[model samples]
Target: MIEIDELLQQEAWRFWDQSLSGKSKSALESFAADDLLCHLVGQGQSPATVRTWVHDQTVVLGIQDHRLPFVDDAQDFLRTQGFTPIVRNSGGLAVVLDAGVLNISIVLSELVQPIDISAGYEVMLEFVRLLLPEAEGKIEAYEIVGSYCPGSYDLSIDGKKFAGISQRRLRKGIAVQIYLCIDGSGSERAELIRQFYDIGVQGEDTKFTYPDIKPEVMASINELLGTSFTIQDIVIRIQQLLQHLTPKVISQSITEDEVALYQFYMQRVLDRNKKMLEK
Candidate 1:
């Protein structure tokens, strides 16, 4: 596993906090933003970046999710539950994203040899561990069976998962993304996905096995740590952690050039999503 310091020892870091951008930003734009950052960072046009985002009532689905026999109906179910559904251009199954869920992405350049897939995951896992020092040994990275988007790098305490990490690579840059269940009921979020799969699969066999989604095996950090930490609190913690790790933490949004690039990426994502859902 790569140490936290090793991954964050850059001379400076760029930080983007878009958690309160309101509903207009949408989760699709967030993924496109990460792709833009990945390209810039990979080409050495930008420093390593840490971005935080939150979208109201959004459910990000994996590519495999679109292949479900009744995916359109499953999406309709999510809409009835007040959730906007979009297929993310990354790995992992469907995951809920609300104001209570804090999403973070660490964009790094693979300038040398390609970064090991596990190494990308370890970077986010170690960063989360650093963010919540109080959790200490309680935080473990392993596949939490029955959890939504369950993966080998699922961040959990005692057995219930609170976060899952996924990676998106572009132009030799890697965007390691994680959604931390900062506040609210993680089980409730899992239950939402549980229903999605139930309606999606309807007892039919799938080439890719979706999680059984035992809601009890999932929890928010607040619930697991017995603390009342909010999204803003965790955002502050991320800033402070970055400050301590690097000499300078630059706060900025994408540049004008990046805005153009972001538009191109956004259109690509929009097109892909429309195609997937329309199928």
Candidate 2:
């Protein structure tokens, strides 16, 4: 687990993307920011940053996800369904991203203490618990079979997964990220991926085992709790939690250095994505 007591006491910055208009912002930009933030923190030029981002009608596929036997058919299906499919330069299965799904990335410097994979996951788990106090003891972090993007650190309530955590490290800095399905139906989201796999795999035996997705195994927080929770409500909760955690939560924008680096990383991501699609 992350040394929470140690982490909260440190100076931190926050970046909340005001992309309520949805399609105005690019999901690839978020990936680039994670790369840039990691470098800045690793170099001691910036403090840890917590960034909130959201993308609409996008399905981010892992490298493994792109390896599906009939991947072209999967891509075509997604496109026809009005979903922009992009291959993420990270490790994870297919995950749905949209305006209702809030993504939080905790970018931390590893200068003082090395953050192992498990510790990184735990930090995000702790943050989720902080955001939803009502879910304190009920939320469990474990793989939920039949859920899209199932993993050991899948965050669930009862038996339905509402979130999943992943990490990326660069230059001694670590970015632990989680996607919270705060609003929309999580089962509906899972069904989309299930269809993608059904079209992509066509019963072919792949070395990597694609999930036998069962949409019933996933649901949004609102659905799980039988309450109407909006993304804005959760954003406000995040701000409150950050204010309580730090002496001052400095709102930041992209610096010149970060902007330049973002352009570089964005190009790399695009190139890799194009290569994957071409394959």
| Estimated TM-score for each candidate | 0.96, 0.95
Poorest 10 consecutive residues of model 2 by lDDT? Answer: 15-24
Root-mean-square deviation of every model? 1.5, 1.6
Clashes of each: 0, 0
Off by over 4 Å in 1: 1-4
Question: What lDDT score is found at residue 117 in candidate 1?
Answer: 87
Candidate 2: segments with Cα more than 4 A from true spot = 18-22
lDDT of 1 at 261: 91
Per-residue accuracy of model 2 over 1-279 as CA lDDT, tens digit each: 457657655666665554464445668778887888888887787888888888898999999999999998998999999899888867899999987898888888888787788878878888899889878799999999999988999999999999999999999888999999999899899999999999999989999999999999999999988878788888788878888888778777787766787788778877877787777
The lowest-lDDT stretch of 10 consecutive residues in candidate 1 is 1-10
Q: After superposition, how far is residue 184 of candidate 2 from its true place, in Å?
A: 1.0
* lDDT, candidate 1, 1-279, per-residue tens: 454567777788999999888455678888889989999999989989999999989999998998998998999999999998889755778999998899999999888556778888888888898899989989999999999988889999999999989889999899999999989999999999999999999999889888898999999999999999989999999999999989899999977777889999999989988887777
